[model samples]
Target: MMRFVFSLMIAVALSPNAAIAQDKPSKAKSWNLTGQVKARFDAKVVDMLCEVSGGAACADKCGGGTQQLGVVRKSDGRLFPVSKNGQPIFSGAMADLLPYCNKDVEVDGLLAGEGDIKIYQVQLIREQGTKKWNKTSGFTKAWRKQFPDAGKKGPWFRNDPRIAKQLAADGWLGLGKEADVAYAKDEVE
Candidate 1:
């Protein structure tokens, strides 16, 4: 179809090494490096996101800094972010947000008019293993009252499956749920 062919043609034109072509709105997922929007490059709030290869400082940042923020940029392209600042942009921890880099998310960031791109912050949405839910008015009723003030912070703390497993291993009648964790022992010699 003409649409497919046009898309392919735009893609080819957008490559860094590709020659200039007539101006066209870039495909959402693809960028054109020719003109206009390409000119938007080095312009306000828009830029070509590049992958960072490897280096010492880059290692520490992308590896685990785990911080996200909005930054200010200047005419010389110097950024004030605490990391490598004044230079490093789309790469390292920052580039991890690249559409290709993280496929799980739907990118909804922004391109401000001051030669800087703003990201809303990347988040890992999935957590595995058992997760606890609130209990209703059962034996747990009274527990909800003193839970916040308890040194344990809540019945849930003592009721962690890990904690229960350890207690049972130590010969206690370990209860699986928070409410049961407070059971009054009746067996004694």
Candidate 2:
């Protein structure tokens, strides 16, 4: 009985599972997209800023609408930034994820771009405990269905002059400059 107990204690001390069970939450976590690949992973939607900085108390308070949401991988605790069309800022991803903050979710998407600043162009998202997948963003879906041709020329460049004026004013049109994806990637992260 003494030998058995000592062996069990040594086993527990060296077990990887035991180590992981006591591991602290990941800090300084970041995602990289060195290759184009499709992946689906279970994660919790978290505010990247708060999750890495020990801001647990503020996690729920920072709504998806206010903070850029990222997926904290259930397996490894790494965070991957989500976006649409390589544009996270204006892609409506943030607002679409407002309902999923702090929830366990399955994300399906193509990881695009190179280096640490990559975009996971989310093709689908589904709550893990739920049965259905949300393939289309509700906000963009309604707009696309309502005006099929309005965005045929590109969503930012509409035929309506008033809409054009508003887009320009809002800096969505990019004005006299192009939104350089490479530049943006280097600038962020």
TM-score of each: 0.18, 0.54
lDDT of 1 by residue, 90-172 (tens): 22223332112222212111122222332221111111132331111122323334354444544554644555568766535
lDDT of 2 by residue, 110-139 (tens): 655654344566656789888776753555
Q: Could you give the C-alpha RMSD of every candidate to the true structure, in order shown?
A: 21.1, 10.9
Q: What's model 2's TM-score?
A: 0.54
Candidate 1's TM-score: 0.18
The number of clashing residue pairs in model 1 is 3
The CA lDDT of each predicted structure is: 0.28, 0.60
113: Cα error in model 2, Å: 2.2
The per-residue C-alpha lDDT of model 1 at residue 76 equals 33
Residue 77, candidate 1: alpha-carbon lDDT = 41
Deviating ranges (above 4 Å) for candidate 1: 1-61, 66-104, 115-189
